[model samples]
Target: MGLSPSKRVDAALRRAPAFAAACDDAFDRCLADAQGAFRGVRLYQLADAAARLHASLRASVPLVRRWVPSPPPRARVDAALRAAGLEGEAELSRAQLGEFAAELFREAVLAGAAGIVGVGVAARAAPAVVGRVVAVYAAGAAAALYLSLG
Candidate 1:
């Protein structure tokens, strides 16, 4: 095997600090879920963790945005949030957020810097959603993609 999931996470930590910090915080926030994502190395478990973490982040969006300097434009934020497929205030399941995040990352890449920067706020405001398990998810598969590449 090239590397275990834990090893991959260590590599990611070395590769990105903000990402790593978000991972670290996520670990502290939800130990079982974090373990599920980091140690289990199962996509299902990882996806579960991503959903919970996203929920945490979703719940705390307003608080996190306050800390971010000049948050992304409302239009872009709304557009991205819309991708989550929420009907009013209905909560999303892990699968739903994961699907949305995966697609969002790909679309963001095509959108260029603006799209990338739009999602960057998640990094600075990662916590309060608890260790940001998504970062620790691989530092989180879909959550990591959502935060890093969203």
Candidate 2:
């Protein structure tokens, strides 16, 4: 069987340092600037799907303007990630990252390329985004774990 959700989140937290650093460098102000578009788990999952791209400098989102596009639809994200073998994964190998990155960038470009970053800032902020999601996710998971144990 798969791990409990709490265990899974904790595991992700253990591997969260690098992504967290990226968040520190970019997401805080931008999250507010997104005007609630990037809040909570939506932001988290976007990063999860784009984990590979976020790590690379090519996808780094620089906060300059006040407006940001909305993230892509989520209905197909899980299925696509599963097909990519990335669903629920905390860490990814370089080869896997390349495959996922190309797919995500392609989709993001197709979805919205409003000159935000030559593709679209909305779906492209995973590197600048996931750390906050991890923090929020881990906090929620910890609460769930505590309540369950208590």
Candidate 3:
């Protein structure tokens, strides 16, 4: 059998450093693209995504805080959000944070798929990948519910 729900989350947390690095690289690329596109609107969107992702990571994987010695990448992302004019207001609630985590999971899956497929992964493929990733999270949540109800 596969790992339990909590185990899955634990495994994911163990992988957080690598994931965070990949996310930062992706976010930087997106920011560059955004800056070139619409006078930084795209950059702001990316910054928001980065912030939401950071917050979700913080919530889901508390071990991450101890893993890093210096200012973490997520903190830098949050700083970027403030610099982008999204300060003093939490842009994402709990539900939104969950959604952002799902999205990040999806992006990681898609990136891996693209590497395996050896082809260009289109932006349109994101939603489908995200759906699949969210389904995994849903299953884990369901398992937690079953355990709690037991």
- lDDT (0 to 1) per candidate: 0.38, 0.41, 0.43
lDDT by residue (1-150, candidate 2, tens digit) is 867543443344324444344444334333444565644223343454444334432333321011113333455444445656776665343344444433443344333322333322456667546555556655764454444323
- Tell me the alpha-carbon RMSD of every candidate: 16.1, 19.1, 13.5
Clashing pairs for predicted structure model 3, backbone only: none
Stretches of candidate 3 off by over 4 Å are: 1-7, 10-15, 36-150
Instruction: For residues 63-150, write the lDDT of model 3, one tens digit per residue.
Output: 3332222222455545444443444443333333333443444333223222322221433456667667556756664554334323
Mark the 10 consecutive residues where model 1 has the least summed lDDT.
62-71
Clashing pairs in 1: 25-131, 26-131, 26-132, 134-139, 135-139, 136-139, 137-140
C-alpha positional error of residue 14 in candidate 1 after TM-score superposition, expressed in Å: 23
Q: Which stretches of candidate 1 lie over 4 Å from their true place?
A: 1-75, 87-89, 113-150
User: In model 2, where is the ten-residue run with the lowest total lDDT?
Assistant: 59-68
Steric clash pairs (candidate 2): none
Best by TM-score: 2
